[model samples]
Target: MKVALIDYGSGNLRSAAKAIQRAADENALTLDLKVTARVEDVVAADAIVLPGVGAFADCYRGLSSLDGMIAALNDQVITKAKPFLGICVGMQLMASVGREHGEHPGLGWIDGAVELLTPSDPALKIPHMGWNQLNLLQPQHPVLAGIAPGAHAYFVHSYHMVPRDRAVVLAEADYGGPVLAAIGRDNMVGTQFHPEKSQATGLRLLANFLRWRP
Candidate 1:
């Protein structure tokens, strides 16, 4: 199978590429993975991975900057019904809109908004960095097959997605309160944390993503 790891000048693509490659190797699957920005490449891929870093508006602009990229993504992912995984800001971009940088539009694949993570506790950090435990809300999700509850994942963001439909939330983590960790519906799945940096837990999720049919 072919997987397109989108490169929109958002952040480092090496770690995500290496992790997914490792997952494919461990699974003994002959996978062709590429870090690409081309719409044609995205259209031809079996699975699509949209990885992002930095601000939501910036990432959205970068992804949409390429002519026909967003439309192609919609055609391939939404129309074709291909499996898709969005990481971090990429996941945030799936929301209908984002509050970061003065309310920017998003892919709207998922019915939600990306808003700043507001920890009720006065002492909690803004970025919500470091390791945090995941509480699985959708245990039967294919992308979360081997992932266990309370699994620690690396997170480094100040904003989190708040989906309009609660059923789309796959998992959540506690910051000052419940924070979104993962969301999914049909063939679409997203993670607020970086699976590439989460070591064992991350790798397990990556492996599951590689093997996931939907």
Candidate 2:
């Protein structure tokens, strides 16, 4: 199976690639995982993973600058129904708009807005860095298979996707309140945290993602 780990001039591509490789090896599944910026590569991929770091507007611009990328993604993921995963700022891009560094348009795949985290307690912090436990909302979801409730995942972001529909939230984490840790619907799935950097929990999620049918 071919999995396209999209390189849109951002994200820690090497780490994600390595984690995917490790997951494939552990699962004994032979996968053609290619990290590419080429639109053609994404068009032919069985699954697509979009990982991003930095501001939402910048990442969106980086993706939009790539000729035919947005169109290819729409065709392959929205129309063709190939599985899609977005990580961190990548996940934020699925929202209708991101309110970071001025208002920025997003892919609008999910009905939500990316807003800055406003933890109730002032001492909770902004970025919400380090490991946090996932409060599983959709325990039966395929992308979350083998990932038990309360699994700690590494997170490094200030903005979070405030999904319009609560059902879309696959898991949540509490800082000062419930933070959207993951969301999924149909063939699309996303995580606010870096599953690649979450150690065993991350590895399990990656493995599940590879084996996921939808």
Candidate 3:
């Protein structure tokens, strides 16, 4: 399988790549994994993985700056219905718009908006960092196959995706309130937590994603 780990000048590319490669190796799955900024690579890939870090506006800007990247992604992942996984801010980019720093347009793959984390408790931190338990909403989803409810995933972000349609949310984490941990519809899925940093649970999710046919 060909997996395009998109490089649009954001995300921990090396770590995400290493983790993905490790998952493929462990599963004995043959994969041509490419960490690429090239549009052609994304066009030819069997699956797409978008990993991003930093601010929403900046990440969107970086991705949009790449000539034909957005359109290619829309074609390959959206139109073609190829499997897609977006990490952290990459997941946030799936929303219709983002409100971090300023309002910016997103890929609109999912019906939602990216906004600052507003935990009900006044004492909780802005960047909800560290390990948090996942409350599986769609545990039957292929990408979440072996991942149990209450499984811990690593997170580090001040923003969260608020999907307009609640059914799109696959998993959630409680941080004074419900925070979106995962979202999906049809062939697309995204994780707000960094699966690469979640150790065993992370690897399992990645492997499930690799083996996922949907």
**Pick by lDDT: which candidate is best?**
3
Which residue window of length 10 is worst by lDDT in model 3? 140-149
lDDT of each: 0.92, 0.93, 0.95
Model 1, global lDDT: 0.92
Clashing pairs in 3: none
Off by over 4 Å in 1: none
Candidates 1 and 2, the one with greater lDDT: 2
Q: What is the lDDT of residue 65 in candidate 3?
A: 90
lDDT by residue for model 2 over 1-214, one digit each (tens)? 8999999987889999999999999989889999999998998899999999999999999999999999999899899999999999988898999999899999989998999999999999888999999999999999898888899999999999998999899999999999999999899999999989999998998888888887
Question: Model 3 off-target regions past 4 Å?
Answer: none
Q: How far in Å is the alpha carbon of 82 misplaced in model 3?
A: 0.7
RMSD (CA, Å), each prediction: 0.8, 0.7, 0.7
lDDT of 1 by residue, 23-142 (tens): 888889889998998988998899999999999999999998888999998998899989999999999999999999799999999988999989999899898999999999998888
- Residue by residue across 55-128, what tens digits does model 3's lDDT show? 99999999999999999999988889999999999999999999998889999989889989999999999899
Superior candidate under TM-score, 1 versus 3: 3
Pairs of residues clashing in candidate 2? none
